[model samples]
Target: MSDTSPPKPVLFRSYYRDWIEVYKKNAVRNVTLRKYLLTLSWVERLAPDLRLSELTRLDYQKLLNDFASEHERQTTMDFHHNIKGAILDAVEEGLLEKDPTRKAIIKGREPKSRKTKYLNHFELHKLLESLELSSTPSWDWLILLIAKTGMRFSEAIALTPKDFDFSKQTLSINKTLDYKTRTGFLPTKNKASIRKIQLDWQVLMQFSELTKPIEEDELIFGSLGKIFNSTANHNLERRCKKAGISVISMHGLRHTHASILLFAGVSIASVARRLGHASMTTTQKTYLHVIQELESKDIDLVMRAMSSLN
Candidate 1:
């Protein structure tokens, strides 16, 4: 005799709570987990009692639209992606008949305009000249290193004397500071971020002297304790004003470094590696405006060359 069993009814909220606890909590980093939790909070607020099998395409679209009403386009896209992942898993588990989030339209409010974040080469030189480097580790020293190396704030702050190779003229970036955990060391952002950036002789010499007295394992800039990015940015802005250049944040120095290299005709792949980017695509997207300007100059050169050939 055949026996029939009733199918279990899984609520979206219940399934999602289990999903995070079982899969996401251990699989993702703290930063990523925090974002997932925020998205989960939205789900709990909007559709707590909705059953997985009962959710329709329109329901999913409405969820995204409701969240997007307050967020920017990029942020809304992230929210949709986070929710869609859980829904797709439910589909795989036979909790739902089909994907409800297919072709969902993303909507969001307009983002605010911001001032330019990078300075031209001439302006960068002026800003660099204004920095007063000393044997003691200060923000000026940090600013100089960032302007020259294009390192992320955490990566720069995590540097120890041994990370620098004076003979090879290289600066190693194998780890980063975990400010969230207040841990002194953490893994780099990605595998690509674990790299040795080549340094100019002047910079190498300066740092070699600066680090000579410090222990190899001791952090160069650890005296500042926990770094506050906003406070550092404010200090950088003051330095720019004193130097009579356009004000930019601490991270903007990385942009300035990359922009100068790209303007000097460095390959995108090289710039991407120098910045420890995961791929050339990221470098291309970040510097699209600069790349476009370079393309225009290339067109002028092409015309001149063809005319001269005739």
Candidate 2:
């Protein structure tokens, strides 16, 4: 037998980060990669100073036991499970001794459901206008792009000049950047996420202008050697505060765009294609409120016509 053992220091960083890298390398979308990294950051905060090998089931359980609400606890519990799941994968790959978080009981937590808060059309336009008035013009364009494209913030930030097809007016959103993996080659949350979007005229125009002085392999939104979204977001938040609007996430623009498209009589497939959704189901679920409104309006018109006929 060889005298060498596996690197004990390998598991020192967050296991969640390692899994994120795995996802990135697998070609995951940038947005999904970022969310996973945020989840990992939360885990790191709860177990600050603890190494990967230092994790215990009890320690993991302890992190979730202190939530004020069952809902909060459960939400955190799922996040806990994800981290533990990552560690388990490491163990399977001979990266660690065993799954230290496996036997840990998340007993105090209660089940809870979660949903994303999306923005409305008026709110979106207001924010877009406000962003334009800021010192950073890049954010104004970047925010509008996501709102129109329904790209996750990271996906938008990780976008490169090569990802755009100005001639076809199409965008290929395959690679993503994450805190764990700063590259575009990563696995997105779902199989369908690795899809393409045909850009609208406005998006194409903005992209063309942005890439005017840049190269194809270079990131379209590159800054001083990094993606520019975070700094843009910070500036955006400051601008929103000055405008007396709530500083919402960049992703909220995605919801606003979806709703507006549905209201404007765009087909679900068309919207899904632009948003790079894997299926119509995702597009429908996301815009269910707008769909219901359309249904209600249709019913009213139908009833009015029947009465007129009588």
Candidate 3:
């Protein structure tokens, strides 16, 4: 009689493919899906022959150590996080008798020096003053929009003439352009990202006239053919260098916007809303340094008031 027993398990890389296809492929954005696919490529490289049934804590630690040898700590942590989900699911499905990733120690190369992520208010003023705004929209307008509104690159690019409510002086951010793949409009980062940001009158007036002759549904900035994030960052860098200020990336403008708001005593909750962060915890973590400085000022104010009463 022919054998009818179940077949032995496949390699861990094969198992990961099945898991990602089932759990991730259609469930995430294209950008996120690419990250998961990149992780799979790494899995194939590091553990091509690792069997799901033969995985152990020691085996997993070795795998992580190998990946950590070249990557920084934070990147290794992300790699571990990406693969951990698949391993946990395998354990739940009885592919492994126990979790192999348990108690795995993460390791990586030393981090490089961090670049300045944001500018102080004075530096930002000089940068803004350096922009050559014209009657028509330009990348400078895009830069100004991000610096003023804290909108993501994708969000700002997706703006339409209709998205601006001239009467209310508000700009609606409900979607994002897939600039990476040029896949047209995609949903906002999350539910909280679908919001309207109130604009200052000067910005409101400039955009109102700029969009007046354009079709309601037309993109405000026009066609940005083959434009990448680096394109904008380079533009900003040149402008910064010209203005004799610290060079920062396009996203740095978003950071500058938030930092200025936090330093000016805007509530964390309000800043979170304006930045379209899913939660205040994210805002708190990102701007913790600014918050700490504000706390020091608050304590000094309290002491001065108390001394006055005495």
Best-fitting candidate, scored by TM-score: 3
Off by over 4 Å in 2: 1-69, 72-116, 132-137, 180-184, 224-232, 242-246
- Arrange candidates by TM-score, descending: 3, 1, 2
The per-model lDDT (C-alpha) reads: 0.89, 0.67, 0.92
lDDT of 2 by residue, 226-292 (tens): 5455665676677667666666666666776777888888999988877768789988887888899
TM-score of candidate 1 versus the correct structure, residues matched by position: 0.93
Model 1 per-residue lDDT tens digits across residues 23-113: 8997877778899898889889988878878999988888888888888988999998887888899889887888999999999999878
Q: List the residue pairs that clash in candidate 2.
A: 23-187, 24-185, 24-186, 27-186, 27-187, 28-186, 28-187, 28-188, 29-188, 30-176
TM-score of each: 0.93, 0.61, 0.95
> Residue 59: error of model 3 in Å?
1.6
Model 2 residue 4 CA deviation (Å) reads 31
lDDT head-to-head 2 vs 3, winner: 3
Count of residue pairs whose backbone atoms collide, per candidate: 0, 10, 0
lDDT agreement of model 3 with the native: 0.92
